[model samples]
Target chain A: MTHQDRGAADGTPRLLRSGALQLETGGRLPEVSLAFRTWGRLNPDGSNAVLVLHALTGDAQVADGPEGAHGWWRGLVGPGRVIDTERYFVLAPAALGGCSGTTGPASAAPDGQAWGSRFPFITLRDMAALEARLLDLLGLASWHTVIGGSMGGARALEWAATQPERVRHCVVIASCAASTAEQIAWAQAQTAAIRLDPAFRGGDYYRHDDAPRVGLGIARRLAHLSYRAEPELESRFGRAPQGAETPLGSPDRQRRGRYAVESYLDHQAEKLVGRFDANAYLSLTEALMSHDVGRGRGGVDAALGQLDAVEFFVAAVDSDRLYLPGQSEALAAALPGKPGVEYIHSSMGHDGFLTQAEQLEPQLRARVFG
Target chain B: MTHQDRGAADGTPRLLRSGALQLETGGRLPEVSLAFRTWGRLNPDGSNAVLVLHALTGDAQVADGPEGAHGWWRGLVGPGRVIDTERYFVLAPAALGGCSGTTGPASAAPDGQAWGSRFPFITLRDMAALEARLLDLLGLASWHTVIGGSMGGARALEWAATQPERVRHCVVIASCAASTAEQIAWAQAQTAAIRLDPAFRGGDYYRHDDAPRVGLGIARRLAHLSYRAEPELESRFGRAPQGAETPLGSPDRQRRGRYAVESYLDHQAEKLVGRFDANAYLSLTEALMSHDVGRGRGGVDAALGQLDAVEFFVAAVDSDRLYLPGQSEALAAALPGKPGVEYIHSSMGHDGFLTQAEQLEPQLRARVFG
Candidate 1:
């Protein structure tokens, strides 16, 4: 099925460009259009399948989509790319409990009402389960590989652990085995920002005024900072004045948000608010905060022991603050038998997977495709 | 002035324990007490003075106090230490917009009303101004040094730039020249959590039933995670069980907040609530969000130019998520004339200044005393 847009003006995921398909969230809402795209042709028997999961704000279009030619993983998924779609049937699905297609707070209900705040909370595992169902519907049993980044990486890990027989390989990049207190805290903080926006109206913004765009903007700005490095920010906008004047007063006399950095944050906020759903952001953020694959599996060490059969290819960003590169190292170490792990050195904090496509491609090809 | 507890359960900044001083936030109810302890006999000249600023949720007593000498930085402030009380005449005052022994929301006002939600918004510079006034009240002239970490480091940067003559040396550790979009976002998130709490009651929780402890807990948990290393968490927690079993189900079958790491986060949350005021936390967190040394300067590079005369010792924590070491590097690079910079490697995140006291002491002594 070709991916389609669901009346969205600025697209679904903050990063995704197109391919909106509807899916059921199993909540109060009906099936929601999920925006997704596929890379590489589906081989006969579909045994050469590789599922690519996106992070908290990721979508289906991994690298190039059919009509939406622009690829998220531009250099990594084409021709002889690391995740060469040409060689494998690659499926990048919008995560469950997300704003993109799959039933989320933005989906319409049987009553012709948008789910809005009526959506039930979902967990990382729930998202993985939804993907499993989608696989079943597609008449394909996972065989080749499962790859994910950040939150996507977490889902990939869960898929490997929960359904070991479904796949032959696993590639988790720039993500943790379970959400850390720090990750949970960051997620909680983002969730609160959306909720605090006066317009949020307790997730009932749909029926009321516009979404908590300001709050969501602020949230996006914050996440953007974590997604990139301090040096990168400095190199790009080191306190230069915006085209506008400083709002507080004279420079050297007052203190306020005057630098270009501040302006950059403002721009980010504006972009996110215009494109993303506040409730979906909050719900997905909460799901990330609640993620803990090893919660009931003894401890992280013991829990990792459950994935004895999985082949691991983990990646970490050197300058990532959200998912510190060291977490990747630890995840690799904790697995029963040490799994192959690597680092994707980049100044783009946790979003390195998208930006460092060239570096990640080889890793994906050697471990997953080979 | 003898620092002794003026016995009163009233939540006021009191000269509780030894060297503790009590004062109400100006024009507010709930006279808060500031439990402070002075180090080194204040020289008759008072000019041989150094002010050690603490980060958010930090108190005045850096070492021993009536509360059995509990302090976050016990290693750096003792006799013959880096900030040796014997000669340097050091003063570490609780910040004005704080929950500890200071006029904060939880403190009872003269009218028996807790400032709660009534406190005015404050900025980082405003906080420094209050401390400057405190210095004036103490009869101190030019301070020999202004040393701080994290938010405290921001204060030090402000002191040297805003009051260049007053501070001869500025020691900034694990801090940024300005709060990045990401940092502000994190602060906003924490604020939202507290504000959204029904118990927060618009910050007047004292008059209401529940304090926004859950929200505050969540905030602290997030902050604590930022202050420590990602790998450290994996090594320490790694999904370890909390020793006890679930009453509702078998330990093996249980799925809840069962990990020791989760318990550790709970402990941190409880500790903050036991001693901190939620309103003060909101204020300080906002202040941090608003922190920007380059706000009114020509630019970040131009802002650093203002520090031409001030001596600087820049430090960074390798694992700190909030204040990445790269920030220090950027600040050092921006400084017109190259300044001495130190990178302190530690597993502890931003809190490395407190947790790795032994490693910090010699550095503090060499920089502050030498």
Candidate 2:
């Protein structure tokens, strides 16, 4: 498959690089390729740059494609928007351990077969390291701002902590220094579901007739609930029928009353399975589960203590269930100085960073691009 | 166990008959004798009575339980409490699917085997019907008041809607007309986890060496998160470490960190498993998932319209994640005349009905007994 076949969202030239990257799995991933898209013109000094991190299942495309829907972050990265293309050069890279034209399980192995079940375990630090290498290749030393939400937030924190001198400002929204026990528990359960799907076949389902769609759908459904608030779910689909029936004539109900919420969940599942790779989903979720800034460092507090950047903005979603607001507050408090942490209230819950960007733009601009 | 073991907490003679009460599973449950404690004493007419409801896993005892802690609802059952034990003889029957002194899976069958894998599915209607049978045995045609919290609130609601003439004043605290899609989804995941353990053996783990304790513990941990609010969990455990390594070593470490919340979950799981039966927990959790007051009655609006009670008090916990506060408000609004619904602010989430009794007392007094 040629690189052009993948197609860029906004006619931007997609850059592809191949190399060997060491993974936390104690295995070396050789001949890796990263797919990335850039917005705006890089200055002569190549210093006026901002990285736009994407959420789970998102790609480097930040604009609307010729057909289908716009990129996931279309709300925040368009012309004259928060991450405006008129000013700072924007970089949106497909994350490591992902499927969107990036080196992942779908990548070819040294033996000329698909990596499939052989991809090394990826981590947040590894993702940041890859990005840092990309920045180095572009002749840029320090980033003007590193901003992200959700797992992107984790990567942002990793960038600030692992390469402090290379990042001027770190804007982490709706995320935590580390995934909480609750988050890890959910991820673990999702991984189990994916692995148990008969079609998963130890991640070698790439050549099989059936994919682990059921497992991937289950993961997406669970994550979708965390991304949206209970109030939103109830308001949208409270005990409403799905207008469908199961083979047993039980109304095709899985979760109580055949409510429209179940239908919504089904839609999310179907969408994820249709567009995403189950292996990449599993790999990234596992990385999220292993996300502990203090894993090798003393503890979370000690690891956070190493962050000396004065320009730190921690934004929390009040209704976030996965990485609750308190986690963000704790992260903010751990910074050397008392940086002002803000709460972005939205019924969207954890996905508030993507949905309620307007309410949070002032703080984002003041703390990052300002 | 003999009849003496079934006496009231104060050593008084229990009036209700205690027997095996053959289950739908065709098993003769032993050690299933009921320990019923009544308040205000049975009247000669047997009509001046209020049937009190208890939360999930609560027992018939509603006051001081000998040397044990106060019964689950001691605050709401005294002389001047909401139910007014002084004027109305109150009866709180342990739920049919409970692990208390009720006919549950832990009870032995006629062949001297526990009904671990033999317990049939129980529904909310079935539970309310059991209470009806108990009232019938006592020669009472109807109840003056039906009061309950959480699952108890659920039972009270069922009593009012399913048997309107049998229930006059219905007081539901921190309950919903139906389990939301989220609640059902959680319950399904918990059940699936417990059943996934090989030793679970189709719920017949009583004779197995490994009782699927890990699976059950994980289930309880998940349930516990829903039971308490994010604020409560943050305030209580936050990021505090447990200061010890799990016997399972570092894999547990990778997933659970060292947070005190992990320890708290461990404690809750142990408490539930030690005092309760895993099979019964699964059965009851599934039963709760099956609880939909709107099942075959058109929908929630129509089902709630059927409640023709003399008085109605619908209450919900402000931070309840499973059953949103809006749901309780919707239920109250949908009542025949749009009765006043009470809001109880507690950080205990859905478990506020059991854990935050003080927050519920005022609402109970102002709306029920008043």
CAPRI quality of model 2: incorrect
lDDT of each candidate versus the true structure:
0.67, 0.70
Candidate 2 lDDT over A209-301, as tens digits, reads 899776677667667777787767666765555676321113111222344555677688899899899889977876775677776778778
Model 2 lDDT on a 0 to 1 scale? 0.70
DockQ scores for all predicted structures: 0.13, 0.14
Q: How well is candidate 2 docked (DockQ)?
A: 0.14
TM-score of each: 0.72, 0.76
lDDT of 2 by residue, B1-370 (tens): 1323322333132434355454322333343444455666665676567777777666777765456657677666766766666666777777776776666677676678887766655666767766676667666678878888877888888888788888878888777888876776566556655665556787777876767775676677667777777666666654456776421123211232334666677788787777767787876776676667777788778988867654787888888877778778877888888886777777678887676666667666665555
Scanning candidate 1 chain A in windows of ten residues, the lowest lDDT window is A2-11
> Per-model TM-score of chain A alone?
0.87, 0.91
Clashes of 2: 1
